[model samples]
Target: ISLIKKEIETFISSYNKSLQQKDKNIKISDIKIQKNTLSLNINSQGIFRPHNALLQLKNSISKEFGKKHKLGVREIKINNYDIQFDLEKKPLKNVTIPFADVKFKEKQATISLNNIDEEFLQKNYIDRMINLVNEKVENQYYEGKGEFWKLIWESGEKKPIWTKDPTEEMTKLDWLKQGPTKGKWFFRPQATAILKTMEKIAVEEVLKPLRFQEIIESNLVPFDIWLKTGHLEGMPGEFYYISEPATRDVEKWERFVDLIKITKEVPLEELEKNISTPAAGICYAQCPVIYWSFKGKTISEKSLPVLVYDNTAVSGRYESGGRHGIERVDEFHR
Candidate 1:
């Protein structure tokens, strides 16, 4: 880690010197190394310029590390950046009117609003909503001259326009350089927006009716209790520990695990089953979960169906592969 940090710092110095030649006012404030991943905090005079610099830095780091390390921009703070243009807030065009095609048998025919099919209503509503969203997103983030959104690839090519379904040509084209993989899915802004929009649609149109609620919870959970509950079945006992340094002290590690197990009263067999290694035992001190939920028993049939949504960070271990990217990482938000 120290050696990697030094290499990163040296690269940053050279990168900054190059930027000076180009009259670019961007510099790395700090470089944080976490295992094999690098997080860089940057300061720049413009918003987009910092992103460009980050991409360059990532590419440089990837070349330096030779595919063993992953790099990410932890944060970018623009010193004097300002939004110079406004998104034209125009009314939606081609709005679809629900039930507009309904035919009346007679001049005085009437229909109840409730009589509309739920499936039809939902489909139409979501279609119209998605259309409006797409229009807004396109207008604000269109890729062309005089557009509000401007993104350049690491290869100095203009990014293609955002599409509902990116074509083979578009997908093959290079756009961003912030991930282990280099393809359409690695374009952070577009990919993140697409995922978020899909999740929103699922929650609002699909899962919402199924009694699932969007929830906000911490990713960290009691490790022993987590194990006792049989949450990490089948998978190996691999975890990212928050209090890892304390585990080096034998007494503290034992006391920590003992305290959690005693508090939760986890069965001895279950504890043994979960904590297979010293690392796993120490990781039980601070385990990360994507999400969790529990409901109290109620004797009413109305409460028979209980649903929950857990969205949080999860950690896992994986062997190295060329296909690995943001999708498959040691720590990721589900």
Candidate 2:
């Protein structure tokens, strides 16, 4: 312990001499040693570059001591970057951030970023990660043959249905009309008839033959359900979300009604203010709720293969730019 203390003192004295030459305003004072730990107060009159200076000092100590010591700071100040954090507790301690400059406050932190090579980060990290993900997706999901997907098994076969072209009359039928937003369409009778026929064939011929029972799922599912089903993470920004009114109080509704009566339209700001955080999302895939239905229920081995399918209620998606004819509409039934 005495040797350690003497070594720390010697390093501190050397470091202080360097600081004296370069930054006379910054000084370490009130150095105390207790149980293999050295505590020192840094006084720089708020003008010192806290993060860089502290990191440098810590690195220097590590280099000198060779992992015999570690640096733990109580607080630090940072600049040049905006960082926000929410803490439910006070008197934060033992905070550690690697390769970052940080200023610590009660509930927030500010960070100063060091110069980085953007091209290197893009090429080495981002692009490499994307390429790895694409490789996995192509190898497993797209290229692999599935038991249920007939297209993969029959890809080499030259079927008459595959060569059929749309009739000129069918092409000119104007079977689809644009809806209120992009990626939405109104199907005309001709289109609806074809869709209904397809649905009938799918249910009557394909599903019913396989003893698959029909199940109708709700159009709006809670966000919690989506989270559990992995859709919230997997399909981010792909589904349409919905929220309840901010207040359920009768007085609030009455006030809203009065304002609506006066304006003959919902006040935009008020409307926005009244909408709460997303409580639910419009069903993107009909099967998420179906999986959720089986939660917490133990199915016997006798009920081993439970098959069900949904063919009602249009699922909603926010197709940013990939909208085409009746085939790829945002509001679609499956």
* lDDT tens digits by residue: candidate 2, 1-334: 3457877888888887787677787787677778755656565533453334555676687677765654433323322323333333342342334444545476444433454333323334433333333343334443446556354453565658644333323447777667667776666799778879988999899999999998888889898998888888677899888888888887767767788899898877777776798889888888888889999999999997999988775799887776666666788876
Point out the worst 10-residue segment of candidate 2 by lDDT. 74-83
The clash count for each model shown is: 0, 0
Q: Specify the highest-TM-score model's number.
A: 2
What TM-score does model 2 achieve against the real structure? Answer: 0.52
CA lDDT of each candidate? 0.48, 0.65
Model 1 / residue 327 / CA error / Å: 5.7
